[model samples]
Target chain A: MIAYRPREVIIEAESWKDPATAGILRNLPGIPRRTVADAGRISASRDTLILARYRGKFLKQCQGSGAEMCCNYFTASYAWNCHFECTYCVLQSYLSGSAIVICTNIEDFLEEIGRTLGRNPDRFFRIGTGELADSLALDPITGYSRRVVPFFASLPNGILELKTKSDQVANLEGLGHGGRTVVSWSMNSRRIRRSEEGGSSTLEERLAAADRCRRWGYRLGFHFDPIVHYDGWEEEYRDVVRQIFSVVDPGDVAWISLGALRFTPHLRERLIERHPGSRLPWGEFVPGHHGKLRYFRLVREEIYRKMNAWISDCAPGVEVYLCMESRLVWERSLGVAVRDAGHLSDRLDAAATGGA
Target chain B: MNITDMPIRDIDTANEECRISGELEAPALVRSLRDIGQLNPVVLLERGGRRIIVCGFRRIHAARTLGRESVPARVLGPADFSPLHPLEFALRDNLAFRPLEPLERARALDKLEEAGLLPETIVRVYLPLLGLPPRADILESQLLVARARPGLHHCLAGGILTQQSVEALARMPPESQDRFALLMERIRLSASLQRQVLGLLRDLAAGDGASWGAPLDGEEVGAILDDPSLSPAAKGEGLHEALYRRRHPRLTRARARFRERERALGLPGAIRLAAHPYFETADIRVEFSAPDAARFRFLAGELERAARGADLETLFEVDE
Candidate 1:
């Protein structure tokens, strides 16, 4: 695991007064701390941490472009940015500031989730905490999962997916998740993990952790998202798929998602500026719906077709879906298309609930 | 610090020291000279017992055009001036008045480096003063354009060649740059087309392991360029299409296969079958225009029938 040491911690005056903030501060004993009147005053830097209260709705729908097929998944805004620097990370463009903002008002966040789940008891809600941040990269420091996992376990129809690229699952062990919380890893080929996913866990470490999660009675998920197209990608990805089945049983895996490398046009310039000498932006791209740049249709279809074939060959019974893809792409790649977001939600719910 | 009126004939107008070119007379400045007289005095340096013009070449020419026997001048001793001092004065004075053309900017940069100024110092201090980016790459690109063949420099000054296009051309051999510049000038290619052609040439050269001129000398390229009946635009379009085919042979075959499959489908002219670019996508888009409900219903029925045809799958089949 990559050790994360913030240069300094800037706490909001109100947040510093919270008891939870006091406990979090005690975890990082030697880090310098200063109290700020508001989180806005603290400039975000990669090495700085800002503990502030989150005032917005904690549960938000994933802002998928309506033009594409959406999985109808929701996200909980527990944190604002990630510490790991993936070369094509959208956070580099989405977040104006760099400071890792961890909302210290856990009570308020959990209360909102409880109220939301209570209001929709009959609705199957699949919410993830890794949209804006790595769900578990900083969990060891904050131990927020201990609070979130149990609350989700009590929900009648909601499932919490703690997606991460780190092996910080020891805290998650022994928690009474009741098989409601899913531990997912944002995985890539070993070659990609070493070169592109900087400061993230190795493929072996992540698989080992997945095995641990399986043993702990939690469902498992894997995301092959932002899959880069490079030379010899077929062999590399085939090796990764082979390794995944060898490490864990196919029956334990809930679902796997495939998404190609795509980004907004605004992120193009930022990628070049932030990661000079990066070949990620050199591929041929066309302007897609919602202003995102996507690989040529043929290129994306070929990749998906190959990946789906390889994964199905290994784990024939496991569910594989496309994330934020068009209906045509879904039909061409997976041989089936959910009617809409609601239908997609139903399919995923079945998979997560072991009904698939 | 002597200010006196010097006869226009006595001033060395043919001095090889001056780097500024093009029309020396500006109508506004000439109008000012004709109306209010010379507002600023021209600087001169006494060299070889003759006064060489240091700055204000335009003002002197305007004064001469206005039938003035003499113009206000400031004479400085040669002892205080170095060889580059006059060029420096000319550059700074012109920069204060207006933005310099690309060639003029290139010449100023060249003179600065020749005068013992480091490229780093030029990029930091002088580039911004000239309204250019303070980057070493920009400095180097400008220097390359400045040092290119005279025809290429003329094209740069004429705004026929963009900085990006010139930079790309600069990477080629001098002979190739000259040939491409001539071709571009003949075809009157827009800045965007210039870039595309240069990119195609570079890719073709790299793929073929030949010189840049080899692609230009191809039979298809020569035929397109020599087609006298075709308009320049038509020739340009034809050349780009041909070069694109050469550069992406696989994509060309895929496109040809798609066209053939689309043709075999025998859909109405109003109905268009389009595939994702490079066949990188399996999605085929069918578009048609319907003027009324009946037509719309008919088109929908036709599309439904076409979807059931076996040839529809061929449209999505690509080599990848």
Candidate 2:
């Protein structure tokens, strides 16, 4: 049993350099070292175990305006800074340090989610908790999705997209996913996974997990968001698509989202400072309509055209969409533009609900 | 005025220990001299009892330009063997006021060698400090072309080249020097064949040249390439598509997918667009109005005309 304190005495931790977790600690801003007693509980444990719980607010939703498309999904929790140190993560900019934040109030989070879904039962909300941390990443320590998915299954109007880059789906093996919850994986080409994304599951491992989830009557989705630009990228992406279709049926997938590499300006600086060798952050970019720097519109269209074409060939009926792109981009690249944000939401809802 | 303040006798050019004491005279050199003093002193050497300059010719010119009566100097032995002594000194002197190209350096060296210097002597005395092959290729190539004929030299220097120009040069009864110059110019051949012709041309001139390559035979090109009137940017775009198609023949099915969609929608004939580098890899999802395509086509057209009129001058200018 652990002692719990809501408000603790504040102490500044100057610097933390533990050999066991030195790799992750070095890249963060210097945190002054100090100790807090029973003021607020300081949970201490082994290097692997994460301390967390159900929270007050589970879904952090961002709704799009009518003119823009709403591939805008929700991030449930703020904590869980990744241990993987993937060069592409947006967390490096958002969080001050690598220390994973595990919310101790899980039941409270689920209750809030229950109220939101209850209030807007008719309006479809596609939400997920794995935005900051890999959704199921800290499963061993927190047993998060194990606790949340069952509750999510009870809610019929909304679907939970538990996205991850981890092969830790063993926790969900016997759960009644009921094809209601979508298990999505953010995938990259094998070379990218090997070079840029550290501590993430290999392409084959993620594919195997996706295959397993499909066999167990779960709806699966793949996100090629942050599809990095590199030499020989076309063949590499095509090979991943081939591997995907080979393992799971098109019907098993709710949708596939293609997004070119993009991030907030602050995130770009953090990525470069932390991962100096990362070249993806420094590609040809211009400020887009949304004010975030994006790859030139032409570049986005090119990536969309190639990947959409490959997906259309491999899995003929799977719903293919762009994540957080302009209507012009959609029309120029795919010739399919949602007339409005509502229509975009309707299409995703339809795909998720109709999936086997 | 004190007589002692005046400079004494002009130093003997052939004297190894002789020194000159006046500052450089060129306005820029004088200004620099006033601000920074002389950083590099002139070097002179004696050969056959005549003063020969081993290096610092431009410094002498600058000092002369600045109206200085005499310049400082160190006389070297005829057999001096300092690595990079001559070329380095020569480069520093010539490059002080104006940036000099390798070709121009070759020309300068050519004149000096013609005045009775040996390449072997230059190599032994100056080439050692030029470092490995990476650092030496440009200088060596320049020297090699300089020894060749003017046509070959211009060819290596990226003079106007076309199939016709190449054939004309090839057929010109082989003069050894001309043949050598043409040989150097043909280095651009491999790049052109890979369809990097424009890039090679851009590299040739300091600015993007207004035009390059074989002059378009309007009829032959009309039959093969896209309609030039539609847009040069579009045409330039077509080149990328052509290259992509050439590289990945598998994208044919992908093209078919787009064609089928266009046909089903009852849209007009699809506009030929450039293939992006990632065209075959990622999903292309687009939604836009008719006005967008038209606007994009017009922009592409303007870019194409600019591309068509490209010269080494515009291509190599300091980009904004």
TM-score of only chain B in every candidate structure: 0.85, 0.36
User: What is the alpha-carbon lDDT for the whole of candidate 1?
Assistant: 0.82
lDDT tens digits, residues A1-356, model 1?
68567989999988976677987888889899988888876666889989998887889888773756888888997788888888889888888888998899999988998898899888988999999899999998889999999989898888999999999998998999987898999989888788778899999999999999999988899999988876798999989989999998888888999988999978976776676556677554666767787776667777899999999999997988888788878887788867887788788899887883
DockQ, prediction 1: 0.23
Relative to the real complex, the DockQ score for model 2 comes to 0.02
- Which DockQ values do the candidates obtain, in the order shown? 0.23, 0.02
| lDDT leader | 1
lDDT per residue for candidate 2 within B34-134, as digits (tens), equals 67756766666545655555454445665555666666666655456354344345545555646444445555545545545566654554344332133
* Model 1 lDDT tens row, B149-203: 7777767767778877877677668898888778866566677777777767765
Worst 10 residues of 1 chain B by lDDT: B16-25
Fraction of native contacts (fnat) of each candidate: 0.24, 0.00
